[model samples]
Target: MSDGTAERTNEARGRRWRGRVGLSIQSKLLIMLLAVSLASSVIVGTIGFLNGRQSLHDSAIDQLITIRSMRAAEITTALDAVKRDASLHSRNLSAQALSTSINEGFAELQQEEPEPEDRAALETYYSDVFIPELEGRTGDSYGDEAFIPDSVAGQHLQAHFTTQNQDFDADYDTLLDDNDPGDGSSYAAASEQYGDYFSRLVREAGYEDALLMNLDGDIVFSAYKGVELGSNLMSGPYRETALASAYAEAIATNSVSTVVLTDFERWIPSLNVPTMWVISPVGNDSRITGAMAFQVSIDTINALTTGDEGWKEQGLGDTGEVYLVGRDDLMRSSSRILIEDPEVYEKRAVNGGIAPSIVKRAVEVDGTVLLQPVDTQAVEDAQAGESGTTTGRDYLGGDSVTAYAPLEVEGLDWVIIARIDSAEAFAPVSEFTRTVLLSLLGILLGVSLLSLLLAQVFTRPVHRLVGAVHRVAAGDLDVQVPQGSRDEFGDLGHAFNDMASSLRIKQELIDEQQVENEKLLHTLMPESVAAKYKKGDEAISEAHENVSVVFAELIGFDDYARGLSPEQEISHLNTLMRGFDEAAEKAGVEKVRTLRGGYLASSGLVVPRVDNVRRSVDFARNLLGVVERFNAQNGTSIGLRAGVDSGTVTSGLVARTTLAYDLWGDAVNLAYRVRSVTGDPGVYVSQTVYDRTREIFTYSEAGTVEAHGGTETVWKVA
Candidate 1:
C-alpha cells in the first residue's frame, strides 16, 4: 500500500480506539463513587451545621427572654412596693392633718403678699441657679418668668428653703435635713413640727422626695425642700410634665387605693435629672382632699435594670443587658454601654445615627433615662404590647438577639428588653459553621483519595498491595505490601511500603512536637490558665477577694550555698524545692513560684475557701517540717522563716512574650515583709491572718511592724 493509504488507515484505527476507551469502567466507577461520597458529605455536614446554628440561635433567644422576664418581674415588684408605700402614707393621720394644715397656712399666707426682698431672692434662684442648671442639662434656654411663682406663699417658701440654703445648689438633696430654713414663716413652722415625720418616712422608705399637693394642685410641702416645694402642679412650669399628668390622673381618680406611676422625665425642679413620681390621693373613704407624691429614685430603678452593675454575675454576659424603653422610644433605664464606658457609648451612639447633642446631654447628665433613643424594631413591637424574641438592629445599630415584652406597670407605657450583640450571641454558631466546612472539605479529600486508590488496585496480583494501601489510608502505618512478584507490581509495593514508613515517622514527630508544646504551655501556668491562653485570651487576670498568701525565706541558705560547688548547690536547692512543693500540694496550697532562696504559695487563689487563712498557716507549718527534714538528711543547720497574711490579692499572667503567673497585693506584700522581720526564725502572720485563724490555731502576740498605712501587728503561730 502507499504511504497516504497507510496514514488514513492508522487515523481511522486511532479514532476507533478513542471511541472505545473514552471512559473506562474503572474511571466511571471512580467518578460515581466520588460523586456519591461528595453528595453524602455535603448533605450530612449541611444538615448538622444548620441544626447546630438553629439550636444556638434558639438558646440565645431563650436566654434573653428569661432575662427580660426576670427584670420585668423585678420592676413590677418595685412599683408594687412604691404603690403600697404611697397608699400607706396617704392614709396616715399625720399626712392628712399636715396636708390640711399646710394648705390652710399657705392659703392664709397668700392673702398677705411676700416682701420685695424675698420675691427678688426667689426670682434670682429661678433665673440664675435653677434655670442655668436646667438649661445645662436639657440644652434648652428657659425664661425665668415661666417658672416664677404667682402665689406669695410659693415665693416665701422658695426664698426660705431654696435661695437661702447654701448647699442647695451643690446638693439639693441635702435640704431634706434642713427642716427649719429660719424664715419664721408658717411653712417653716409646719416643717419644724412635721419635719421629723416626713424625714423619717423618706429615709426609711427610700423615697427620694415627698410632696403634698392641695385640691387646687398647689404643692404645699416638700420633704427635701426642693424648688418643687412651692410649685403648683396643676398650673405651674411643670404642668406639662409627666409629674403633673400623674397628679391630675390621681386627683381625678379620687381614691386613696389608686396609685399612679409616672414614667421617668426631666423635672426642672430636681435640676432636670430623670425623675418619676408615684401619686395617690390623700383622703378618707368619705372625702378626697388632696394628692401626695413620692419621688421614685433613679438609682433604685437603675439598680434593678443594671443588676447593681453586676451584669456578668447576673448572667448578662459582656455585651448583654436588660433595659426599659418608653412609648416614645427613649430609654427609661440606664444604658449598659453608658454605664461601662461613656466615651465608647458616645462614639457608637453618634455612629448609630443618634444626634451628637443627645449623646452630649446623656453624658452631661450621667444618665441614659429619657435620653438615649432606642427606636428599634424590638422596642416598637414591645410598645405595641407584643412579647417575643427576634434578631434585629439594637439601639447602637449593631445586630442583636433581643427579647422584649411590655411592662405590666400600671399608668406607664414601658417595655422591658433584654439584648446582646449578634456577634457575641452567635459566636458559637459561627465557630460550628467553620468547623463543619473544614470537616466537609477533609471528608471530600479523604473520599477522593480512597476512590482513586481503589480504582488503581483492582487486579489479582495487586490485591496484597491494595490491602496494604487500604491499611495505610486507614491510618495503620505498620502495613507492608508483599514483594513476592518479580514484576512492576512488586516495585510499586516496595515504594508504597516506604511511603507508609515515612508517613508514620512524620506523624510521630508531629505528635511529639504537640506533646512538647503542651508541656511548655502548662509549665508556664495552671491548666485552666493555659487553656485560656491557648484559646487566645492573652490578658488573664482575676481578683481574689480573700486568699491567704505565704512568703518563706530560706534562713541561712545563702551561707550554706556559698560552701558548695555550683552543681551541688543547684542539686541541693532542687531537692529542697521539690520537698517544699510536695508539702504544699499535700496541704492543699498552690505554689506560686520559687525565688532564688525564697518560696511563695497561696491558698484559695486557685480555689475559694472560707478557711484559707488556716489552710495557709498549716501549709507554712508544713514548710517548717520540710526544712527540718532537709537539715536532718543533709546534716545542715538550715532553717525556714515564713510569714502569712490573709486578705484580697490579685493574680494573673504577666509578660506577653514569656508569660508568668504571679500574685501581688497588700496581702502578698505584707506576707513578704513579715517574713524578714528582725526576730527568730519562725512563721509569723499578719493580724488579718491571725484574726481569721485564731479560733482554729493558737497564736502569740508578736511585735508590730510598719505597714502600708501604719503598723500591722504580727502574731507568731504556736
Candidate 2:
C-alpha cells in the first residue's frame, strides 16, 4: 500500500477503537440499574438493621431496669420488716426481763471455772468440728486457739450445748430444751426460763437466731445456744464480727427506738456461713441493761434478690439474674449460676477473674453470699449511688446489658444489679440482620441476571464482542471476536482480534516471570501476606495481642538419622514436617517457621480466635500423635516434644532482599525455652496457656524454667 493510504487506514482503525472504548447505551443502562439497585438494597438493609438493633437494646435495658427496681424495693421492705421485728422483741417486757436475768446469770456462772473434762471437750469441738469446717469453707487455716472461748461461762455453755449434742448441725433448736449438764447452775436456770420462749419466737417469726448482749458486750443469751452464747463481743474471739458491731452500735445508741443493722459476714459461731444482725436496746431509755439482736435469715434475702428461684418467671430470660453486692465487693445473695450449674459456675467464675479460692469457698458453703466477689462496673456505679443502664462485660467476662441501683436499707452499704447476656438480648436483631442480608443477596442476583439478559437481547450484534472483551478483562488475552458482518461491528471485531493476538504474546512472557516470583514469595510468607507483597506492600507487619505460640522438636531424630543417607534423612524429615503441617491445619494453627530440629506454629496470628490457646495445645498434642503413627509404621524410636505459650507477638517481613517472615515476642521466646527445658518428651505449656485450658485438659506442674531473664512456671498435659 502507498504511504498516504496506510496512514489513512491506521487513523480509521484508531477512530473505531476510540468509539468502542466508550460503553454501549445498553451497557450504560445496565450499569446504572445495578448501581442504583445495590445502593438502595444496602441503604434500606442498613437502616433496618440499625433501627432493629437499637430497639432491641432499649427493650433489654428497660427490662433490666424494671427488674433492678423491683428487687431493690423488695430488699428494702424485707429489711424494714426485720428491723420492726427486732424493735418489737426488744421492747417486750419479757425480753427485757430475760436480758437482765441472763446477764446476772452469766456473771454468776463466771465465778466457777468449768471442769477440766468439760474444757477439753469444748476445745476438741472447736478444733475438730467448728474450726475445721470454718477453715474449709473460707479456705483459711486456723488453729484451735483461734476460736477457743476465754471466759469460763462461755466455755461451759459451748461444751454443754455443742459437745454433748451431735445433731446440732441438722437443727440448732435441738439444744434449746437439753439443759441436763447445767441443772442447778444460774446459766442453766436463765436458759430454762426463756430459751423455749425465744426458740418459739424464732420458729414463728422465721428468724435464724435471737441474741441478748449486755452493755458490756457479753452475749449472755442465745436461743439456739451455740458457741456465741456467754461469749464477750467486747474482748472475746467474736469481738470483730458483724454481731459484735451490731451489739456495739446498739449499746452506743442506748435508746429503745434505735435499731442497728449490720451487713453479712462470715460468722465463726455459725460454721463460717454468711450471717447478719439487727440489734435493738433491750431496756427502758432511762436505764438500758443490754441489747437484743436477731440474726437475719439469708434465705429471706436470697429469695427476694433471686425472685424465689423463679428467675425466668419474673421476665428474666435464660441467663438473666438479679443480685446484691455489699460495699466489700462480695455478693450478699446467692449466685444463680451456682444454683443452676455448679460446674459451669465454677469455671466461669474462675475464668472471669475471680480468685479460685473464692470460688472454692462458695462451693464449700453451698452459697455465694459474702464469698463470691462481684467487683464489676455495675457494682461500682451502683455503690456510688448511680442508677442507670449500661452495656459492657459482666462478672463472667461475657458481654451483657446491665441495670444498677443502690439498695435503700438502713445502715447497710448494699447495691442491686440486674443483668442479661447480650447474645440472648440481641438475638432478634441478629436474626433480622441475617434475613436482610439474604434478601439483599437474592435481589442482587436476580437484578444482575435480569439486567444481563435485557442487555444481550437489545444489543445482540455486540454480544460476541462484549463476551470477548469481558474474557480479555478477566486475564484471558487469547480471546478473539468473530467478524460475520461487514459493518462497524465487524471492523471493531477484527481490530479487537489483532490487538488481543499481540497482547497475548507479551502477557505470556510476563506471566512466566510473575509465576516464578510468586512461587518464591509464597514459600517465604503466608499466601495472604504474599499477595500484599505482590501488590507492592514493602513494610508488612502486624501486632497480635493474644496469639498462642508452639515450639515442637524431634527428640531422637538426630541420633536415628546418623546412620541414614542424606537422601533418606531429607525424605524422612520432609514426611515428618508435612505431617505436622497437616495436624496444625486441622487444629487451626498456622506454621510460622521450621528450624534445624524444631517447628514453630501459632494460632490467632493470621486470624484471631478466642480459643487460640486451646487450638495451640491441641496442635501440640496432635504433633505427638503424628510422630507416634510414624514410629508405629516405620519402626523408628523417635519422640516429639512441644511447648506452648499464649500472649502478645509481632510478625513481619524481616529482610529487604531475601524476604523472611518471622515472629518475635515474649510468647515465642518462652515457648522455645519451655520446649528446651530438661524434661521428659511431652507437651508442656506456659502458665498462661495452662490457666486458659486447665479446666478443659488435665495437667501436672512441669515446674519452672528460666526464660526472658525470669522464671516461668510451666505445666505438662497428661
Candidate 3:
C-alpha cells in the first residue's frame, strides 16, 4: 500500500482501540471495586479473626492464672494462720509449767514399783495381747519397745496408730514393767490444768484438738483425751503419716526458723478428711525443744478453691475449674464434676480406669474434693515447681486449657491448677470469627450491588465527557473540557483536575511539616505525652511499675549567679543544663522537666525495662561528672546534690493552662528528698536504686533520711 493509505489505516485502528478501552473502564467499574473491596475485606477479616482467637485464648489463660493465684494466697494464709497459732501456744507460760511438772511426775512414777493387781493386768495386756500382735507385725518397731512383756507391767494406756491408715491400739504397760511416764497425783494435776487449756484451744482457736507433745514427738497432754495423745509418732503406728513428716521437718528447722507446712494426707482415727499440718518449734531462748503441730481445716480450703459458684464466677466458662494437686497425685480440693454430679462422675472415672476410692467421697461429701487422684500436665509440672500454661488433656480426660503454679506454703509439695475445657473456652472465638465472615460476605454482596447501580447511573452523566475523563484518569491532566455543555459534568471535570493538583501539594506539605512538628513536640515533652496531647487528651498519666528517677539540684546556683550579668548567668546555667541533658540522652534516659536550679530525668518511663535502675545510676553519675567538669573549667563554686530512686511512678502531662509534663508518686518525691542528704557532693541513691545497682556499682550505705512519711535508707553512689 502507499504511505498515505497506511498512515490513515493506522490512525483508524488507534481510534477504535481507544473507544473500546473507554467503554470497558466505565462499564466494568463495579467489577474493579468488587475485586479491590473483596481483597481488602478478606485481608482485614483474616487478621481480625486471628487476633480475636488469640485474644480469647490469652484472656482465658490470664483469667486462669489470676484464679490460681487467688486460691494459692487463700491456702497460704490458712497455713500461716495455723503456724501463728501453733507458735504462740508453743511459747505459753502456763503450758510450759504444766509440761515441766508432767515430766517430773512421770519420772517419779517410773521410779516406784507397780501395784500387784495393776502389774497383773499389765502383764496380761503385754504377754497375751501386745506380744501376740508383735508376731503378726514381725518388723514393727513399736512392738519391739524395751520394758515390754519380759518385765512386770507398769501401767496400761490406750493409743492409736496410722502407719497404714488402720487404727493400732496403744496398749503398752510402761509403769508395771520398765519406764513409761507413770500415772501419779502430780501428773494428774498438771494434766488437769493442761486439759482445761485444751478445752479453750478447741473452743476458741477453731482447731480439731490441742495436744502438747514432748521432745521425742510423743503426745504428753491431750485436750480430747484421744488415743494419739500418748502415742509416739516416731515408733508408733502413725509413723508413716503427715504428722511424722511435719515433726521431722520442724525438728530439722531451728527454733527461730519459719514454720513448716506438711503436705496433705488423711489424719485417720480422729480425723477422716484430708489434713495438712503447720508445725513450729517449741522452745525458750536456749534451744529448739520440740514442735507443736496444728491441723488445717479442709473445709476452709474448699471454701476458697470452689468458691464463686465453682469456678464459673472466676471466668473459667462452663467447664472451667481451679483446684489444688499434691505431689502424691491427689486432689486437695473437690472436683466440680463430682460435686455437681457424683454418679456421672463416678461412671466417667470408672471408664477412665480410676480407683473407686477417689470418687467415693463425691457421694458422701457434697463438695469436698479431698483424697481424689488426678493426672494431668497441671499436676505434674506444678508439683515439679514449674509454672506454665498449655492446651492438653485434663484429669477428666478432655481437651483443656490450663494454667498451673506451685503453692507458697513451706514443706508442702502441692500445686494449684486452673483449667477449662478447650471446647468451651474457644467456642466464643469460633463463633465470633464465623459471625464476622458472614457479615463481611453480606457487606460484599450488598456493596457490590450498590457499586453496579452506581456504575450504570454515574456513567450516563459522564459519558459525554468520557474521552476527556479517561485522559485525565490516565494522568493526562492537561486535557481541556469540550465546552458547549455548560453543565455540572463540565464543572466536575474541571473541579476534579484542579482539586487533585491542590490535594497533591497539600499532602506533600503536611508530610514535611508533621515530621518537623513531631520533633519539636517531643522535645517539649516526652514522645508518649506529646502523642496523647496531640490526640486531644485532657488527662494524661501512665503507671510505670519499674522506672528509675533522677533528681539533681544545683546547690549555690543563686549565689553563683549573684555576681554575673543576667545574660552571662543564663548562658552559664544553659551550658550546665545542656551538659546534663546530653548525658541523660547518651545514657538512654528521659529528661522529664527542670525545676528551680534542678533537673529531673527518668529511665524506662516510656517503655518499661529491668535495667532502668542501672541506666538512671549511670546517667546520675555522669551528671555529677558534668558538674565536676564545669567547676574545674569555669571556676564555679556550685556543688552537686543528686538523688535516684527506682520504683513505680505515674508520668504524664499536667495541662494546667501552661502544659508541663511531670512524674509523681512516692518514688519521685523520695528522689527529690534524698537530694538534700547528698550535700557531701555525689549521687545518692535510695535503697531501691541501690538494690538494682549493687551488683555493678560500688556504694556505701549513707544511713537514711526522713522521706515519704518515713525513714528511707540512702546509699552513696561511689
Candidate 4:
C-alpha cells in the first residue's frame, strides 16, 4: 500500500475505535446521578458518625472532671478540719497552765509588805527564782540572771513593788510574793489538773496530734506519743528561716499558719502519713510564750481519689482503676485492682517524698488518679492549666481515659490524677455506635435494593420514549414511542410520538422556510457575515480597527410621534429607515442600533477585511447615497440628517444574551454631536470624517460650531 492509502486506513480504524468506546447520553446521566447520590450519602453519614462520637467523648470527660474536682475539695476540707481541732486543744491546755501560774503569783504578792529596799530585793528574787521556776515547770526556760537579797524582803516586796506603776515591776513583785513553796514544787501538779481538762477537750475536738513549742521553737508538751518535752526544734534543719518567719507571722497575726511537707526526713514512718503542719501562738500574760503546732495526715486525701468501695459495684468494668497522683507526678495510692506491688500495699511514708514512677505517669499523662486513655489534644490542654480529662494508650498498650485536677489544699499544692481504661470508659458509647451503624447499614442496603426494583418498573415505558429520541437524533423522525399507562412517563411517551408525527408532516415546509430565510439574510448582508452573526459571533466588530462611525436622527420625531397614533408613527419611521438599512448593507456596515428616533451605525475599512482610509470614505459616501434616495422617494416635507466621523472605535457584544454589538470612544461620540449640531435637515460630517471621505461625497465646510460642550469644525453633505 502507498503512504496516503495507509494513512487513510489508520484514520478510519481510529474513528471506529472511538465510536465503539463512546458512552450513550442516558448511560452517562445515570452514572453521574448514582455517583452524586453515593458520595452525598457517604459524606453525610461519616460526618454524623464522627460528630456523635466526639459528643459522647466530651460528655464522659466532663463527668470525670467534675468527680475529680469534688474529691479534691473534700480532701482539703477534711485536712482543714483536723488542723482546727488540734489547734483548739493545744490552745486550751496552755491557757489553763497560764491561768494557774498567774493566780499563785498574785496570792504570794498579797501576803508581803511595802518597803523600797525590801521590794527591790524581792523583785530580784522573783526574776531570778520564781519566774524561772514557773516557766521551767511549763517546760519552758528563763535565761540565767543573779539575784541579791535586800533587807526587809517581804515588807518592801509588797509595799514598793506591789504599788509600782510599771507593769513589769508589779509583775515581778507578784511573782516573788506568789511563789508559794507549794506552787513552785513542780508544774507537774498544775499540769495534772490541766491535763484532764485538755484531754477531755481534745477527745471532744477529735485532734490527731498537737504540740506546744516554747519561744525557742522547742516542744514543751505533746499529745502525740514519743514526742517529749524540751525537744528543741529551733535549730533543726526543718525549722529554717522561712519556717521561723511563717511561725512569727502566725504569732503576730494571732492566726493559724500552715507548713507543707518540706523534706522526707520529717515524715513519720506510718501507714497514714501527715503532710501538713498548722501552727498558732500560745500566750502568757498577754505575751506570746510558745506556739501550738498540729500535724495533719493526707492518707484520707489519697483514699478519696483511689477508693473503689462505691465505684466497683457501679459496673465500670474490670479494666477500670482509680489511683491518686501527687505533684511530683507519682502515684500516692491505687485502687485495689491496680495495687499489686508491695510498695503500694505497704503505704510507704511518702508524705514529704517524691511520687513514684507509676503515679508520676498518671499525673503527667492526664492529671487524674484513675488511669485511662485520653485525647492527645486534651492532654496538652491540661498541661497548660485546663485541668481536664484526656484519652490515650496506656503502658499496657490498652486504650485509657485519664482525668487530672489541681488540688488547692490549704497547705499542700498538689495535683490529683485518675485514670481508667478507655475501652471500659467508652464501652457503652462504643456498643451504641456499633449497633446504630450496623442497623443503618442494613436499612440502607434494603432501601437501595427496593429503590432499584421500583426504578426498573417505572422506567420501562420511558425507555420507549428514550429510544424514539435516539432514533430521531440518528435521522429517523418517523419513529414513534409506545405509551402504556397514564402516568407522567407514559404521557411523555405519547407527547414524543405526537411530536415525531408532527415533524414528519411539517418537514418539507420547514426546509423551504429555512432556505428562504437564509436567502433573505444573505440579501441584507453577506452570507458569511449573516451566518457568523446568526451564530452569535461578534468577530467582525471585535477584530475591527479605524472604523467610520455614523449617527442619524429625526429632529422632531418625538413631537411627530406625539401628534400621530402609535401605529402610524411606527409605520412612517420604518418606511423612512428602510433606505438607511439598505444603504448600510451596501456599505458593509457590520452592526446598527435603532434607539427610537436616534440611529447609530458603523462600518469601515476598519472591519476585519478592509483597512484603508478610502474604504471608510466609500462606506460613508454610501450612507449619504441612501439618505438622498430616501428623500427622493418620500417627496414629503420630512428632512433627514446624518453625521459621520473616522477614528479608532472598539466594537463588540456587551452582553452574551443580547446579539447587539456597539461602538465606543471619541469617534462615536463626535459623530453623534455632528448630527446634533446640524442647523437644518442635511447630512453633516466632522473635519476628521470630511478629510477621510471628501473625495467620495460633495460637501462644503459647515464652519466651526460649539458642539454641545466644545467647539469643533464640521462639513455639510449636500
Top model by TM-score, which number?
Answer: 2
- Residues 1-718, model 4: lDDT tens digits: 9966974785565455445644554455568557756665676567756767778877777656666666667666766666665455435645546434433433344355544655454456547544454354333454322222222222322233222313432343232223222323233344344434434443454444445555655444444322122234555423453334445556566433322222111232111122445666665335555666554434444455545345555333455544444444434444443343434322331221324553444333233232322234433444355676768754333457877765565555455555667777777679768866776676567657766775786676665566668889898987865555534554466567668867887898899999899888665444555667788674644434577777776665566567789898888788757766776666677546776666677766324444334444455556556555655654434555667777776655455465445567777778777775745766778887677667777888776756547788888876
How good is model 4 by TM-score? 0.38
lDDT of 1 by residue, 48-125 (tens): 756787998788777778888988999899888888889989988888877877777788778885689887887777
The alpha-carbon lDDT assigned to residue 148 of candidate 1 equals 71
Q: For residues 1-718, could you state the per-residue lDDT of candidate 2 as single tens digits?
A: 9966975896686566557555655467767887978787878777886777688667777777888888888889889998998898898888887887778877887888567976788778777777776676556788886666678877777777766545446756567556444648876777787777788778888888888887788777777777787678989888877778778877887798899888887777776767888889988867788988888878988889888899999988899998889898988998888999988898888879888887876776678997788768988999999999888998778788889988988798998889888888777777877888887887778787878786566566877787788888898887766666554566667778778977887778889988888787765666777777767788887677999999998988999899899999998898899999999889988888887678999998877799999999999999999999989766698988898999999888877577678898889988987875665799999989988999999998878988667787888999
In TM-score terms, candidate 2 sits at 0.66
> Which candidate, 1 or 4, has the higher TM-score?
1
Candidate 2 displacement at residue 460 in angstroms: 2.3
User: What C-alpha root-mean-square deviation, in Å, does candidate 4 show against the real structure?
Assistant: 31.2
The models' CA-based lDDT, in order, is 0.82, 0.82, 0.69, 0.53
Please name the candidate that would achieve the greatest lDDT relative to the true structure.
1
TM-score between model 1 and native:
0.59
In model 1, what is the error at residue 319, expressed in angstroms?
A: 1.1
TM-score of each: 0.59, 0.66, 0.48, 0.38
Q: What is the lDDT of residue 43 in candidate 3?
A: 80
**Model 4's lDDT to the true fold?**
0.53
